[model samples]
Target: MIRGDLHELNRISWNAATVRHNSHKQDQAGFLRSGGSTLFPEEIELLGEIRGKEVLHLLCNSGQDTLSIAKLGAKVTGVDISDEAIDFARKLSSDSGIVGSFERSDVYPWLEAAIAAGRQFDVVFCSYGALCWLSDLAHWMRDVAAVLKPGGRFVCMEFHPVAMIFDEEGVPKYDYQMPEPLHWDTGISDYVGDSGGALAVSGAENVSEPFVNPNPCAEFPYSVSGIIGAVLDAGLELRIFREHLFSNGWKPYRRMAELPGRRWTMPEGMPKIPLMYGLVAVKS
Candidate 1:
């Protein structure tokens, strides 16, 4: 499929997921409503102080993290391709009395526009399951750099590519080095609450039912070098690259052991694996 077609399919699938995520009792919206941040401690430390700083969040689904950063006194703008997600994010921000701007646009195009408008930010932040959605990391990173001021920071925390190759049963299924986009025709499911179950997407609002998707969605996988190399190629200086043993959520594994700080890890005796990774780069 063409890039536009692929993006449309992904957008629809994400919109469906967003509807469920916005209402899920344990999703980011819920956590943020309870005065919790979806950001990890490592992220907070890496970002440092943001008081009066400008932050641009890419693929910011539902604005939970965007608003959380706004709480830190940052002037934040969130961009997402999913219109439903952006709408939900705006409503959540207003309801929570948090100041943030939400825009419905794909990341690359949005970054391009920001660059043309001479809009630059102190930080460009993206996290957890975000990079896999992009088809071209090198080009994406260039745009990321384009929207950042000189010496601006780019912080990315995402599921480890190594972890993504494994199936729910801890069995290796996919390639560790995937060079092409992977497509799935099965119905899309909410990654958070009620994991593994498909949700329907229709014209109705406030959908609380599950439905099967009739179209396929696509995702591109990149290795560690592919990720970090792109950042370097974009003229961003690598500052920190760290891997975590725990995941932000337990959606990856069929069974997991709960850990401190609401994190989850592979059950004991399972060889310790990198479940997530964080990268902090500075544009120079």
Candidate 2:
């Protein structure tokens, strides 16, 4: 609600970022074609017994992880704001021979439509860097509650807000509570494929030295407890709130070391802090 032209500008920004980000993932289509999964270990463990469940993945950019969930035997539908992202998702689904349903819409209105249509899911899942785009966490949580059936669960794996408080030089300039929304004109980073060893795209390709955006985007950072409170106030019972030190795909700092499976963590002698988290809440 806070960002004016929320639908148009945000969609444009992500549509631009989606193409730029995926270009760095050399042969990503090849990876998926060989039955690759973009899921991290924490996600797999936390989402236990999802086979045959009706899973709704929100903010599911490009459907790499969405198709990964479908590979888990769940009937998964992915919802995203960017038309380019959803187009690539459907294309990837066909190219990779993975079946999934994709929708393009701003999450706020989409959730309302889902609720109005009486569409409810067994599990609502979203992950890393997903929540920051939303301006209203409380309303988002309320709508999340509306679209989940009784006994259904909401599962999220996200970059911890504690870790996000620090600036580029390790200064904690941001707030622990919800900070003022940040507007960025420079666009998103190629964070996913930046960790090195990205294979080359066989077809014609051009890499931008630094991908810039014509459209601006906004981000709203929330605290750990703020997220918990949002879920609780939405009438969902907090089942688990566990924090972790490693990050999936996106490295937070320069000094971080890479772990197995594309995960990154703080090197030895650095102060241990939660970089990411896994949360599960059930609709009671």
Q: Global lDDT of each model?
A: 0.79, 0.82
lDDT of 1 by residue, 179-220 (tens): 678898863565554332211111123334565655468998
* Winner by lDDT: 2
Backbone Cα, N, C clashes tallied per candidate: 2, 0
Cα miss at 283, model 1 (Å)?
A: 1.2
- Candidate 2 lDDT by residue in tens digits, 188-248: 6555444443222222245436555777877888888789999999999998999998877
Residue 107 displacement (Å), model 2: 0.6
Which ranges of candidate 1 are over 4 A from the true structure? Answer: 26-34, 194-215
TM-score per candidate: 0.90, 0.91
Task: Return the TM-score for candidate 2, rounded to 2 decimals.
Answer: 0.91
Estimate the overall C-alpha local distance difference test score of candidate 2. 0.82
Residue 156 C-alpha lDDT in model 1: 89
Model 1 whole-model lDDT (C-alpha atoms):
0.79
Worst 10 residues of 2 by lDDT: 196-205
